[model samples]
Target: MPTSKETSKTATFGVKNIGGINSTEISISPGVTVLTGKNATNRTSFLQAIMAVMGSDRASLKADADEGHVKLDLGDETYTRTLTQAGDTVRAEGDPYLDDPEVADLFAFLLETNEARQAVARGDDLREIIMRPVDTDSIKREIRRLEERKDDIDAELSTIESRQRDLTDLEQRRNSLREEIGEKREELAAKEEEIDQSSRDIEEGRKEQEQFEQKLKELQSTRSSLESIRNKIESQEASISSLKQERNQIQNEIDELPEVPAGDRDQIDAEIDQLRSERQALNSEISNLQSLIQYNEQRLEEEDYEIAQTLAEDTEGGPSDTVTDQLLDDDEGIVCWTCGSNVDRKQIEDTVSRLQDLRRDKAQKRSELKSKIDDIKSEKRAIEEKRNRRQQATRRLEKVEAELDERDSKITALKQERKELTETVETLETEVKELESEDFEGILSLHKEANQLEFEIDSLESDLESVTQEIEEIEELVAQEDTLRDQREQVEDELADKRTKIDQIEADSVEEFNEHMDAILEILEYGNLERIWIERVEKSVREGRKKVERTKFELHIVRTTENGAAYEDTIDHLSESEREVTGLIFALAGYLVHDLHRGVPFMLLDSLEAIDSDRIATLTDYFSDYVEYLVVALLPEDAQALDDSFDRVTSI
Candidate 1:
């Protein structure tokens, strides 16, 4: 069960030309405040004034006034609202207590035409009213986002696990490279010692030997340069191959993207704009028709003396009797207030009724147009998404192609340099061979062995350096394993909660309604009434030629006969008082279920004349327990049965 928060602030309302009230001011405390008055004494109008300042557009402007204002002072804050007649509809301005008052209007404002109260009386779908505040589409979108995040996390964890499996092999390869480099250094030192001893032995031809050694050194340098060029060529080839593969993949993705015809989006946008314009025009026409109908109906019912006299004087060559008589006589034609032409009362009424029908028809047409516009907008969004994906793929493909071209050009240059270096090495080797007389051959062999040993050592050291860096990177990734797992667990829990949110709301609403209905029936003590409860049932419904299963709120009524026998009954058998009580209880259920009391402190009630004064007082008292401020409008006789301790306002 939900409980209302308590407050001690007093609410003061200042009103001018709103609803049926011309102007009024009232202040009520944060408890039960009863407005006691006869009909047309601005009791309901005062309630409307409170609603206007509370951020609701349902309040009406005075028929005779062009503007209205409502100001509310609660605690230390003052909120004001201005209503001005704008052609056909009332335009509201200024700040209010709430930015959006949808929940308040549906649940907290318990006026005569409240949807929750009327749904029960009309036997409409109760589940739809209870779940109106929950946005199922938004919930589904959130679920999709969470699921995508979880998928990404899973993929990252998989990569981390795979890298952990390679850790041991990398360590072993790094150790091997270090040992080979150490052995190669020792061999190079021994070969250098041999070269020094051999060079001393060739002291007799020392100059020739020195010249031959220099040529051999040039040949070794040329060979090293040639090897470097070959290695570069190999690397460039690998890079070019990888880039080509990537370019192909991106091209395939672009090819697979959904095809959206050219200019389709622009055409759809133009259509949606045209439809919106038509709908707006229809709305304006509907508002004008409604205002005209309301003004004319009020004039006819109240019989304004000034309007009647004007119409009487305008009737030329007709009865010159009293204006009241002329207006009252059904057989005589009176001047039309709108067109300034003689017209029968019945004929004018028929025209008004026809106008009302036209308004309804236009309203329905506007609704259909709105739905169509939404469909077209959705289509345009889908087309835009496809176009974006294709554009991204095309950009990636172009980048990969450019990179491949650069790599190919580098490989060509490297091959040409290698060809020139190879020729230079051959020429250097020929010169060294020619300088090699049979006298200093041993010294030359020692030098060549030393050069080979040094190259091997350098290669081994480079391999060792690369292996060590990879080991460090793998260790870093392994450190984050625990943190990634924890995040995955948290996401899984959140996903589960979001998935079942709607189901929980539906169950809670049913339970709340049933429990409260039983308690209220006991308190009211209707002799034959046994119980009135709502059951959540599952059934298949037809939706656009498809049968889908849905959950519905089923209302049940039970009554006991005079012979002490209980039987099930339909809602049609319920009396007016019983129906009214049931409807109010349903509204109360929604209020608690939606937790409206936490935000909207004030609850307004009116038009409870169907229920007796005693029951009405009990209902009011029951409702007061759930809200900080409870305001009810009742007649003088009905107000007598309420608690004397409650604050009462007899005049506006």
Candidate 2:
């Protein structure tokens, strides 16, 4: 139930050309507001006007007007709805209280024709009506999407875990590389010292060895250039190999992606457009059927025989009797409003009943068509996603291949350079050997050892740099492990919610309906009615070629006999008042279960004359406790039964 704080504000409505009302404005405060009038006083029209501003397309335009408008002022927020005739349909526009009013329409509106109320009266599938707002297919699709995301996250975490296992090995390798580099640096320094000593020795022992010393210096410089060229060649070779491997991996990914057909997209789009057009046609047919049924029902219930009398008078050799007299005589039959022929009232009712059934069937078909369109749209989205992924992979593959080609060219150039450097080194060595003598042998050997030590130091430093980079990369991956696990947990939570959402709504609905039904039944005090409850029962049903188990809500009615013995009874045995109360309670259960009072603020009731005036008063009072606004249309006598403190709108 809503609190007083939630219902303290008043709402004002301005309506024009909606339902039977031409134009009117009214202000209603929170709690019970009764619309007291006889039939044809636009009581229902006022309710329709409220519905229009509340974002329901079921509101009808006035028969004489091409456009209708409604405005609702609640608190400081104002909502408006504009209805304009377009071809055979009325299009609604402008901002309203809600963007989508499906839940409110089902649970909060509470009109006589509301599906939830009518479903109980007609003994239709209660579960289907209650679960209509819940899109199981959409829920399943979301679950699948979340599951896929979780799977991807899990795979990445698995890779991260594997990298973490290599962390220790990478650290050890980094330490070893550092030590090796340090040793090589020390050896290179020692060798340089030895070369310096040898050079001093040569300078002191042989003053004429200066020309040989200059040749040896040139040889060592040439050898250093050769070593640098060889290093460049090795680096280029490694880069080319890595780029080729990347290109191959990208190529494989591209190959694995499914190919999108050239014309499939266009064909699917065309089909979807066709389906939408068909759906629109079905909507029009359903609307027309509903209007027809409503008109006929009013004719029957209100005894408005003007049209039927006119038709009967127009027929040749028509009965020279009053239409009222004809209607009162069941044997002679009443004039058929559609054809001017005399037909039984029951026959006309049977036709109307058939029309109602047809409307329901078409409504079901429309729902199915909507689902089909959604399915096709989902398929289109999947196709577009796949095409996007393929395009991205192809672009990446092209870039990698281009890079590989450039590296290959660079490698070829380096190889040529290395060859030239090698030849020059050989020539320099030969020159040094030719200039060699016994006195300079020690100096030459020291220079050779120093060059070897320098090469070894460069190699060790490169290895250390490689090992350090690997360790840093592993550490970064390890850092992402926590984030990945958090993401997986979030996805799992969402997945669980999606998977269990329908079941929870079902269980809650059943529980709410049962609890409210018991209380209302007790309050209404149906003497024979001992209890009324709903059971969630499971049964197997055939779906196309497959058999599946489904849950259904079974309504149970317990009654006491004259002998004071209680027995179970079917819904068929319930009286008119009992049925209407049950329907209203069912709607209330839906209202509470969906928490419509929190958003809708109003519950509208009409055509509830089956229940007695005292019961109507009790019912309205009981319902007023739940919502901010409870507006009910009742006769003047019924209104008298209500509390005097309740607001009464006697005129539109």
lDDT of each: 0.82, 0.84
Worst 10 residues of 2 by lDDT: 1-10
The TM-scores, one per candidate, come to: 0.85, 0.91
Residue range 582-620, candidate 1, lDDT tens digits: 888888888888888777888999889999999999999
- Candidate number with greatest TM-score: 2
* Tens digit per residue, CA lDDT, model 2, 224-339: 77787778878878887888788888788878887799699999999899999999999999877866775566555544456566665666357558654565545436676566
* Cα distance off (Å), candidate 1, residue 13: 0.7
Clash counts for all predictions: 0, 0
Can you tell me which runs of candidate 1 are displaced by over 4 Å?
A: 1-7, 193-205, 258-262, 278-382, 437-440, 457-487
